[model samples]
Target: MTRLPASLLPEGLTAAVEEASGARVVAVRPRGGGGASRDGAELDLAWPDGRTASAYMNYDVHRAGAGDDASFLREAAVLRALSGPLALAGVRVAPYYASVPDQRALVCGLVAGCDRFGAITDPVQRDALAADFMAQLAALHRIDIAKQPIEGMGPIESADVFARRRIAGLRAGNSGRAWDPLIHLALDWLEANIPADMPPPAIVHGDAGPGNFLFEGDRVTALLDWELVHYGDPMADLAMLCLRMLFQGFVPLPQAFAAYEAAGGHSVDRARLRFWRLLFQTAFARRSRYDDPDAPPPPNLGMNLVYSTIHRRVLSQALAEAAGVALPPVAMPDAAPGAHDRSFAVALDDIRDTIVPRLSDQQAAVKAKGLARLIKWWRAIERYQPGFHAAERLEISAALRRDFPDHGAAWSAFCQAVSDGGIETEAAIILCNAHAAREAALLADSMGGLAETRLAPLD
Candidate 1:
C-alpha cells in the first residue's frame, strides 16, 4: 500500500527497463504487499512501434549487509536456472529479465494472478488447486541439484549440517544482544534431534506457503517469492507449507499431506516435519522481535505487534510439543486502570468505527484495522505487562536457582544452567510452558473481543 513516489525511482531504472524490454519506460506504479523485506513496483513500457508491455520490479532495500546481497543474487540465479524446467512442467514462474546487484533491483516478466488463494469458494476447486501446488513442489524437488550448479548455493554434507548451519547463523545474528529464552530452548531441542537419516537435498523453496503464491480460480498462476530459495531437503518446504496452512486455514493439513505424497513428495516424516515446524515458528517469532538492526522496519508498528503476538503463540505451541510439556490454559490477568486507558480505548474505537471505514484505499484500511488492534494491545500492556513480567521473572529465578534483574538476564542464566546440567529438561519445560502461557494470555487480552486464531494445545 506504500506507494513509491516518482522522485524516489533511481535514475537508471528507466534505462534498465528500456534496455531489457527494448522499449521506452512510460510509467511506473508501486505494487502492494511488498512484504517486510522488499519493495516492488510495476513498470509500463512502450515500444518504438507503439506496442506496450508491463514488467515487475523488485528492489532489495532491506539489506542486512553482505548476506542480503548473496541472498538476492542466489534467488536471481535460481530463477534463471529453474525457468526452463518450471515452464516445461506447466508451473508458472515469472520469467527472469534482468538484475542490477549494484542497485539491489531485479526485474521480471509480469505474471497474471493475485496472492489471495483462499478466496476461492468451491471446495473441489480449492482441493484441485492445492493438488496442483503440491505437484509443482514435487517437480521442484525432483530437480537435480548437482546438474544445476546454481551460483551462490554451496554444497552441504547433509541436511543435518544445513539445519545446524541455519541455527548457527541465527545465534550469530543475535550475538551481543539479549536473547529470547524460548528461542534458545528451541535451538537446543533442534540441535539435539536432527534427523539422522534423510533423503538427499533437493531445491527447497525456503518460504513456500499460501501467501507467497498467486492463483486464478482453482489454478495456481505463479509460485512467487523466491527470496529464500536454496538447495536443501524438500521436507523443509513441505513443513513450511503445512505451517502456513495451519495458520491461514486455507487447507486441511492431513488432506494436503496426502495430496503432496500422491504428487510425488517424499513419504510423510511426521517427526522431522514437526522438528522443522518448530524451527520455522521459532525463527518467525524471533523475527517478530524486530531487533535486528540490519533488517528493514515493518510496514507499521501495529502490524509488527500483531505478527509478533500471533507467531509467539504459535512458537509456544511448537515448543511445548517438542518438549513434551502440557501447557496450562492461559488465565486472564486482572486489569488495572491506567490514566490513559480511556483515551486509548476511545482512539481504538474511532479507528475501527470511523477512520477505517472512511479510507478509500483498501490496503490503508487494512493497516488501519491493524493499528486499532495495536492500540488495544497497548492498553493491555500498560495494565498487565509489569505484573506479568514480575511473576514470570520470579518463576524463572526459582527454576534457575539464581536471581536476575530481568527476564533476559534470567533466561541467559537458565540456558547456561541447562548447558551445565544444573537444570533438568522437565524443569526447563515447566518454566517454558509457564512463560509461553503468560505471554499468550497478555496477547489474548489485547485483542479485546477481536477474533484471532487460538492455537490448540499439543496432543
Candidate 2:
C-alpha cells in the first residue's frame, strides 16, 4: 500500500495526501467509478499514536495524454462548498477533508452505500428509494445558486444561453475530429432548438439520475458524482434523469416528478425537460471527451465502442422524437459465423475459465473482463461489419442522391450535408438512426444490460 505503483496512482500523490492529511498513509486501494469519468481510491491513514482512519480519495491520475486539469479542481471546490452553507437542501454530499490539487485528488471521509439503484429486486423497495432520491433532487434544486456563488464554475444564465455556450464548446472541441455524423447533426439541431424560457436557475446536479446517487437499504445515503454539477434550470436535471433512466433503470418519470413537485422543487417543465434531455444525451455522445484529459479512457477500447454505439442510437432516437419523426425500424442482421469466431470463443473461455481465476489482482481481473467484451465485439464485427458498411453506403447515396466510391467518403459527405443543411433533417435522421441501430445490434451481445435501453417517456 505504501508503493506508488502505476496501476494505483502516479508518483508524488502519496506524498501529497500524506502532507495534506497530516498522517502516515498505511494503504490505498483503487476504487473505480461505475460510469462517472473520475477514478477513486480508499486511503487508510495512521496517526503517531497507533490510531488509524479511513478516507476515500476520488481522482484521475491516468490522463497523461490530455492537457487540462480544470475539471477536477472545480469538483474539489464544489465538494468543499457543498459541505458548507452552499450545500443542497436536505441532501448529503461526502464529508470534505482535503484536496491535492496538484494531482487532481480529493480526500474525504468514506460513507457506505450502493450506487446501483436498479439492482434492488423488490419493486416496492426500489420505488421507495427512487422517491427519496427524487425528493433529494428537489431539495438540490430548491437551493438558489445565486446566493452560493461557487468559484471557478461558469456564469449562471438562462437555459437557452447555457445550452448555447455548452453546445458551442462541444461543437468547437469536436469540429476537426468529426468521427460521428449523428453528433454533428444532433448538436446542430440542439443549437437550432434552444428553449426560449428562462426559469429560475438552480444548482443542478447536471448528471442527476439513477446510478448517480446512493442508498442503503430503504434510505437514501448520499447523492454521488458532483463532477458534472453546474448552475442551470432545475428542469434540466429532470431531463438528465430521464436520459440516465434509459440505461440505469429508475422509478417512472410521472412518479418521480410528483415526488419532486411535492418536495417544494420547481414544477416539471416538459418542454424544457425534453430539450435538455436531448442536449445531455448529445453531450454524453460527444467525441470531444476522447480528447479530454479528465475523461479516463475505458480499460478496454471495446467498451468505448460499446458505449458509443448505445449513445449514438439513443441520441438519434431522442433527436427524432424532438423533430416529431418516428424512424423506420431497422432490420436485424443474421450474424453469420466467420473464421475468427472460434478464436473469439476461445479467448472468452480462457478469460472466464483460466485467466480470470488466476488474476489475484482485482484490477487485472476487471481489465480481463473488459478485454473479453472487446473480443466479443470483434467477433460481431467479423460477422457483420461488411454488410453494415455496404448498407450504410447505399443509404447515404440514396439520401444524398449521389454515389461515393468508398464508405469513408460517403460518411464524410453525409456529415457535411448535415452540417450544411443541404439534406432534409428527416432523411438525415432516418439514415443516422438506421446506422445506429445496426451498430447497436452489433454491440448488443457485448453490451449486456446496456443493450436494451429504452428512453422513458417525458410525460
- Most TM-score-accurate candidate: 2
Give the local distance difference test score of model 2. Answer: 0.76
1-459 per-residue lDDT for model 1 (tens digits): 234335546567656656755776666775543444555677666678987667787775445222366667777777776665445545568877677776567777788887776677788888998888888888788766666566555553467777888888766654445466567677888888888877888888878878878888777777887877767777888778866664454567677777888988788787777777777777776645355565565545555555555666677767777778876654445766777899998997899789977986544665677677677777777887777777777877877777889976776787677556678767776676666666656566554432356543222
List, in order, the clash count of every candidate structure.
0, 0
Q: What are the TM-scores, per candidate, against the unseen true structure?
A: 0.84, 0.90
Residue-level lDDT tens digits of model 2 in 119-188? 8999989878887888888877777667767776657676667788888877876666555678777887
- Score residue 231 of candidate 1 by CA lDDT: 71
Off by over 4 Å in 1: 1-5, 8-24, 47-51, 64-67, 102-104, 151-157, 287-296, 349-370, 401-422, 445-459
Looking at candidate 1, the ten consecutive residues that score lowest on lDDT are 450-459
